[model samples]
Target: MTPTAASERTHLVFDRALVRRRLARAAWLGAEPFLLERAAEDMADRLAAVKRRFETAVDLGTPTDAVARALAGHAAVGHLMRAAPLAAGAPDVVADEEALPFAPGTLDLVVSALSLQMANDLPGVLAQVRRTLRPDGLFLAALLGGSSLTELRQAFAIAESETTGGISPRVAPFADVRDLGALLQRAGFALPVTDVDRVVVRYSSPFTLFSDLRRMGAANALAERRRVPLRRATLLRAAEVYAERFADPDGKVRATFEIVFLSGWAPHESQQKPLRPGSARMRLAEALGAKEVPLPPSGDERD
Candidate 1:
């Protein structure tokens, strides 16, 4: 099938081209600093914890240079490069996550910060990352999680339903921790792990939150998102709903940003593996020092 036909067959979620444009505009307008600082610091800490030096590494599609800056002069990193989907961040190369430009087994490490959540073909991207890593190489990433932006989503839904009698997807869908862990394993990574860090940010109002999102290049880019501008009345109602529902006693509205971290290593012979089922030398009952009990037989067994 032609590439166009294949894309049509695939259930494309985010419009990647639009995403790039948004990010470029954000950069041109000087996006807010420290939007991804926490994630970058966490990534640096995680890498530091792993007592190994990566001879070659790439920062994949991070919207900002925070990750690169955080790892600069790090003892664990050598010859680090940055790859971005757009030319916004002065990256070492402009490369799309959907199609990485790395040779197989060429990289020792790959790190993505708050970027993979925008990928339409995330599993495919993960597979490509795995193929680019040398045996026992590491891939560490942070992205928005399913619980991210729950407040905005709910407020928008309520407002749109009441005003327009219909609702559109204003917030992009993010994968849950379990789903991401499974994706890592499917992408041929060993010892896959996933964890979440929920950050509840207090905003003066929903409008402030919206502005922050635009500055962070995280505005809606969903494929099925409404093309028309949001109606002013709808926006007001959304703000009202947000304030009424999610505002704290101190009058600050809450915005949730759940960052999910993923880490896995390319499989190697020396990597630890789970023991085969029923291969245990000792029974579970013996190991636990518990009395064994037999269950009643099923109908077939009784017969």
Candidate 2:
């Protein structure tokens, strides 16, 4: 599908305003930035592996300056700036992910660490990033993947089902690697690549996990999320369920975070392209040195 069509078809899964508010609150509360720091380091390492240098780059909507700091003064990067979602972050540009404020072909690189997963129209945001890049410009990003917080989701679902006799959306949904890779292709990126990094964190209890999630600005911001706070009984039950199911032998509970990394480049003539169908010079059997066998004819063919 075309970019515009894809954007129009995207579901409004997240409450963007809520997400912004939570991010701001997390910043004010001095949220723990370990995840962003880890993502920034990983992205920096990946960029370092590439031979080319980028003259201009943007850190796109990261909650903090972790990515900018990791890449600043690097031999492969120059003139790095941040596009923050809120004004409090003191960003070079105040921009929304869905609508970037850049002219087409203006940037050499764009890196987003632990951002873009909460965007309501992720495809639209990716299309805008692709448009902002010059030919052969690179885009690299990491976002929480579908498997993140699976234990919490399971515990909450079980608790609600047992006590309340119903379940509400407690955790936000995240896209898987394959879907994100397809989005890169749909956004007109060349040589799109995607992979997952699973991070397992052990917490003292489920309550501790909740605290960390809030501090990370990752509390459920789904548009359809439950409005009322979970009942105390339900919360306690969930904690118990979590400990029973996901706890280690040492009595700590484990939380899984799946981080999905995506990298792609703007279309360029210098980049490699797939050969056209029927363009091969040799047969597969000949290349493999194997005999080719003919199959028996079908009944229709015999008739």
Candidate 3:
């Protein structure tokens, strides 16, 4: 395989494992019941109105439990769950977003929640998603954005810089809404839309926030990096700094999760076309009717 293709495959493998670990952690975090219940409720409400519009629907990166609940609630639409390690589920098959195993134009709807941001080649994955959807098919996704872990990131940065004299790139970078919208357009998604919602949770201390992240299985797993054991002294210093800088007036530490929601449709042939050539062109300079005067020629140009 070509280098690019090999890289893509590697990314898919890594992302799949990462997400599976996270899901498993979430399952053990005592929050799976609540999270899956909320997910099922939300999916049922959203798909109720549009369930009849699509013939085949797929949930990318869906957990087994969540998918089961969603399928039970929305039995009208054909549902297929996709995720790494294939979790124990009733999904059509295990597949990766960077390269879906479906035939082109086979799907009518694709839904993903808080999953796409973890992709190494997000644009390529989106392109694949676009290809899988039938013409005029709907695409809906939610992803954690740059603002998702501000407090945790701040604490880490402070600790590393103070203790080690430098910082480590442990956390993955996230795309903003504007950049994500531009990527959607580049991937040929029509009528693309993007919006962000902020969810804040308060913690008693920075250590509690770290514990939650670990339990959520959202720990950093950079491809090219070493995992050094964190020192207790450094961790304590980090907690102190985090509390001092990020604590609210009520003395609670807040962690923010900025989620970006996206929706788009595959272009259809029946959509309106552009105007014919030379038909009512509107140039800004011409509309302003500005005059252009020639300047004196340079010495090299003058004969």
| Residue 127 miss distance in model 2 (angstroms) | 0.8
Provide the TM-score for each candidate, comma-separated.
0.94, 0.93, 0.78
- Return model 3's CA RMSD, one decimal: 5.4
lDDT: which is higher, 2 or 3?
A: 2
Backbone clash pairs for candidate 1 read none
Q: Give the TM-score of candidate 2.
A: 0.93
lDDT of 3 at 33: 39
Can you write out model 2's per-residue Cα lDDT over 1-303, one digit (the tens) per residue? 545566567777888889888888888878888899999999999999999999999999998999988997888898998997872387899987777888999999999988899888887899899999999999999999999999999999999999999999999889988999999999999999999999999999899999988888888888898889879999999999999999999999999999999999999999999999999999999999999998897677763
**How many backbone clashes can be found in candidate 2?**
0
- Model 3 lowest lDDT segment of ten: 30-39
- Candidate 2 lDDT (Cα, 0 to 1): 0.90
Question: Candidate 3: misplaced stretches above 4 Å?
Answer: 1-19, 29-52, 63-84, 87-92, 271-303
What tens digits encode model 1's per-residue C-alpha lDDT throughout 107-190? 999999999998777877898899999999999999999999999999999999999999999999999999999999998899
Model 3, residue 301: displacement in angstroms?
Answer: 25
